[model samples]
Target chain A: TPFRIQNYRTLAYVLTTLVYLVIGAAIFDRLESTQESISYANLQTRIDVFRQQHNMSKSEFENLTRTVESRLNYRKKQWKFIGSFYYATVVLALVGYGHAIPYTKAGRAVTIAYALIGIPMWLIMIQSVGERLNSLITFVLKRIKRHFKRKREPQITAMELLTCEALLTVLTLATGSYVFHRYENWRYFDAFYYCLLTLTTIGFGDLVPMQKDDYGSIGWLYILFCIMFILTGLTIVASSGNLLILRFVETNTKRSRNERYEM
Target chain B: TPFRIQNYRTLAYVLTTLVYLVIGAAIFDRLESTQESISYANLQTRIDVFRQQHNMSKSEFENLTRTVESRLNYRKKQWKFIGSFYYATVVLALVGYGHAIPYTKAGRAVTIAYALIGIPMWLIMIQSVGERLNSLITFVLKRIKRHFKRKREPQITAMELLTCEALLTVLTLATGSYVFHRYENWRYFDAFYYCLLTLTTIGFGDLVPMQKDDYGSIGWLYILFCIMFILTGLTIVASSGNLLILRFVETNTKRSRNERYEM
Candidate 1:
């Protein structure tokens, strides 16, 4: 009966996830498709006008644009020492912004090998850091509780720890978002979006910080700050994820262990 | 002493990771920077020639190129029904190829909300599936062992499980790479890179499958296959990661428990 119940629960989860995905897809399509088509048409009109004005054929204009776009891209100095460090951070974080990916086969091969080793090491490091973070939080919480309620023994519940972690996650996001908003000159909401994306390791690279102009003027301090933000932010988020997922994993492990014992 | 040793180990891990990142950065810079500068200069020359031939000013050419580039980007129809599903899958997986992100404010807002719930749910789903996969493998392995050795109890070791998981991972990558290479018309190495990037959830978007032309001809089956590939590949990889990390986590947890008992 327990096995059957587990099966049903997993099935329900699968179906719910399927439905959830479809709903998300439909909402995105509805919200974005019209705007996408309208913008496409507007851009197409602009392209036609530019071509006519320049008296250039489609292929000629395409060639010219490709060269110009690539030229603009290369102006960024993305393979420099600092930029390469940024690349390594993203790769280790599994963010993979693809803003300035390897152009050569060797670079690609190296990236694959680097990631193969780096990602797991990064994961373990974060999880270890996260565990220490949890212990620290527990200690601090107990201390606070003892100070407040001296009449009773200091006690902390799982619920209390979860609440603390949840608040920390939100606080980290808020502060990080504000910092990025100020630094990147992006709108507050967009900065928040960027922070969340980066923290989650989605890293769309739609808006990355420390561009060519920033590197030229902002100095290494800003670059160091950004990398630290990514690393620290992920550690905090992973701590939260670890707490939530560990309970589920433990339950699954226990159920399997019970089944094994029964057998 | 154990605590101190554990601390030292973590410190060593941290230092090693830092050194690894630095080495990777140096390599990337060395391999890619010179090529980058040369290509940049080449593109600059092409841009200059085109500007002189077209009799356009720098700003005028920049504007033309901007509009043309945006137009080219929108021709892909990335917000359609199927593409939207792909987006949802990427967001859930945290792959985030980002070839086409939501352009609207509403879309970004919804995305954040969606991911807040969806990512954890997806994580649980994959992890549960991975556990089941491990059980299935164990059962199959036992059966095979029994068939080969009738007198034996067919006990499987942790090492055996690990080896099987690793072999399964390799097999999955090989077969998946071959399939994508055939379907997407990419070089075998590129296809393998795409598969690795995807399974690791890096998703650089340097090379994504299923373009507009593919959509026109490939139908829904290919879409389904790609989605399934991502989900299955991630589950397998996560299982391997789970085995490796669980051992480390258990050691850490046991050490902490012993410390608490001593206290």
Candidate 2:
């Protein structure tokens, strides 16, 4: 019942994050659209002035304007609903995949304001879920230890604990690589690399998954699962690292104290 | 002497991180160049084949190929030495601005490998510096408290501590916003937003500072300072948040336990 209560709290947090994201996307969309229209108008005026100043022929002006319009349209198309949502996800998750940027002052302002709230909320949500996963991991590890105790091996050393954590990390990476390679049509190495990048939260966006329209809903689901996997893996890695560092510091301090006593 | 020793360790860590970044950039540069050449060759072959199959005129093919070449050149231009260094910083810091991404399989693999080592190292480095900063903050706060004590207000409450932290955060944001607004030629709100996004490590790259060529060496220095500022700000914010959260959680648990006891 306590775990269930925590789960409900997590669900609430998740819902709140989603709501924040949707609101961000809508605001971004409107802000960007307004900026785009203003820029387009400015461009139009500049083009008109240039044509008039140069006494350009109608056909020449039309050709130049068409080229400009096409370029603008291409830029505009990059901010569609899905793309905007992706941008929102990138910002909230602190990935900042600069594929599509907000060009307007208001858009940039809102982005800063949005991220100020969204990032902390997102972190809290991830940390909450991560804590749960951490407990699950600990429980699983303990069960394995118990099973081993039944076979007459009872003690678990620090090294053994580290190895287990490392093994889990490797397993998670391997599974992610396999699934992404299958779905994203990427090489094994690339998939593995992608898993590492996303898990580390160093999302370069060069090898992002599910960018294709064909993948659709499944792609979104995959991304969601990947986020969970990444968070859990990070928690394990960080905890292990902290343990190691603490041991290192302790040993150093003890050795120095002994040296000082001898002196 | 311990503080001195720690400072030395921090310096060593900073140097090592820089070395790691440089090496990563070099390797990524090479990997990406190889991939680019191969892709260009492939594109050239495809274009030739298409022209041959379509029985296109030489002039028409040349025109088309020139257009394609220009596009490729534009893409290539995004990966200059400085830009790549910036990219490496983005990756290692887990900011991943996605402005300059590794396109090659080898480059991506290296990036993953590099980040696996680099992210933890960066975290350690940030935290090392952060701890120093934290102590400095504590010292400063104590001095401020003592000053108030001299003015006959000796008692310091949790609210006062919280207020002090909040004030520091706001002051940092305001100062950063002013400096960036002046340097980046952005609106005040946009500058503040940029500060928030970056300090939170949600670097959307929509409004990055020190991006103009005119800013030159000064721009680079500004960026370097900004990174330091962001790291320090993050450490302060995280610690303050943690303290607040811990207190909140403790109170909540106490209240819940009391309710259960009453029931």
Candidate 3:
């Protein structure tokens, strides 16, 4: 009974994970095969031949699988984090990307409601956690500095930080537009347009850069810029928005206590 | 000038959003035109018609657009606070969901990297956040009870909360397997497989619940259960994972203080 309770669950979880992998593969393969001349049979045969050439031991094969899996797992976590951020940003970044997924009528209705409530809820939640984490991170960093270097702390309050972030947002948004104009084959407005779309991660595919032959040379540059944009966006959230919420929470809790005392 | 700056930025963001919508419609229309049985002139006419539908009046559209945009912005500011928790939870919630958008090799590389780092981070982060949120949630709830209802507080400690979660993890995995077996339409593994995948919002499409079924009887129930599963999963991350991290941080901070004093 105990064994079934534990091992059964482990088995279920593993199988569940594998099913996800297979489904992902099926969708990807189907799409890829549709776009290319490769047959599923040929792909399988290629895998078989490749496996034979390696002639890997069962243990070796498993180790290789695990290595590949670990890599996949890592990527999943990163994207999920990023993607969750992306979804949250779209909903809460006040950008209103309006790209909520709704594949059916019922789903659409729910999505509309989700957009109404879920977006705000997510925004609040993100802000709350972001502030708390920042405090935790900053607190740790300060201690390390004090312990080792004994550096004099030049105090910059949270208000100053907010103003700096607002300026950064405008600058980053403007720079994003400029890059879209300069490197890619877009008109100035279109460049600004593309920057907004991509940074927002709406990824409308209308003016996606680095795809045309001339612009293709800077593909990696575009990707790097995207990563930077995302990180910068995160910094903005981590700083001002989070601080506001934490202050609100602390203020409310204190106000409640004071009111109780007065009563 | 302040008003003008806000107006211009708002317009820029809006115009950019519209460009995507119009362009998206144009792309689809042109594609449809190419595949049509009608004459090229008629096809061109149809494409123009589609564009007309997507175009917006400057005055009339602006106010409504701003309404939604402003609301979304308010939400975004709020969300930016706690967004980190979601980001972290998503990274390591579960591992190896296979949904990918491989536009280029570099994109693929980033995707691959995400799989490697993001998966464990997702799990670890979720576990960490869940612990903290759970403790805080319980702690607050108990305190509220003490304040309002004058009830004795439940001793909801960290270890107990964590043990319960670990037990749930095994339960989820096992329940997934047994459910897969009962369904039998899915392979013995795929049902439990997608439970984790979808629960985590990886939505890799390798497996989906009731993939080929009509919503004859249990449609609402199915959707409801899925929602419940996801919410519970989130609760786990909020309570268990976050609390543990906070505790770790507190311990380390304290440890260093002791060290500094000793030195």
The fnat scores of all predictions, in order, read 0.62, 0.21, 0.00
* Best model number under lDDT: 1
Q: Per-residue lDDT of B154-180 in model 1, one digit per residue for the tens?
A: 787879988999998998899888978
Docking class of 2: incorrect
What DockQ number belongs to candidate 2?
Answer: 0.11
Tens-digit lDDT track of model 3 for B33-121:
23222333453454345335535344433332333232221221111212222222222333112222232333333333444444433
DockQ: which is higher, 1 or 3?
1
Q: Distance (Å) between predicted and true CA of B202, model 1? A: 0.8
For model 3, what is the C-alpha lDDT against the true structure? 0.42
Location of the lowest summed lDDT over 10 successive residues in candidate 3 chain B: B73-82
lDDT of 2: 0.54
Question: Which is the better candidate, 1 or 3, if ranked by TM-score?
Answer: 1
Which sections of candidate 2 miss by over 4 Å?
A: A1-89, A100-110, A151-161, A216-263, B1-85, B103-110, B151-162, B216-263
lDDT (Cα, 0-100) at B118 in candidate 2: 55
**What TM-score number comes out for model 1?**
0.94
Alpha carbon lDDT of each predicted model = 0.82, 0.54, 0.42
- What are the per-residue Cα lDDT tens digits for candidate 3 across A1-263? 43233334334544554344344344334334332233334444544554465454546434433333322222211112223333333333333222222223333333234344443343333333343344444556566767778787734356655565566566876887788687764667666654543443333333444333344666667755754564455445444544553344334334333222111
Preferred candidate (lDDT higher): 1 or 3: 1
Q: Which candidate number would show the highest DockQ if scored against the true structure?
A: 1
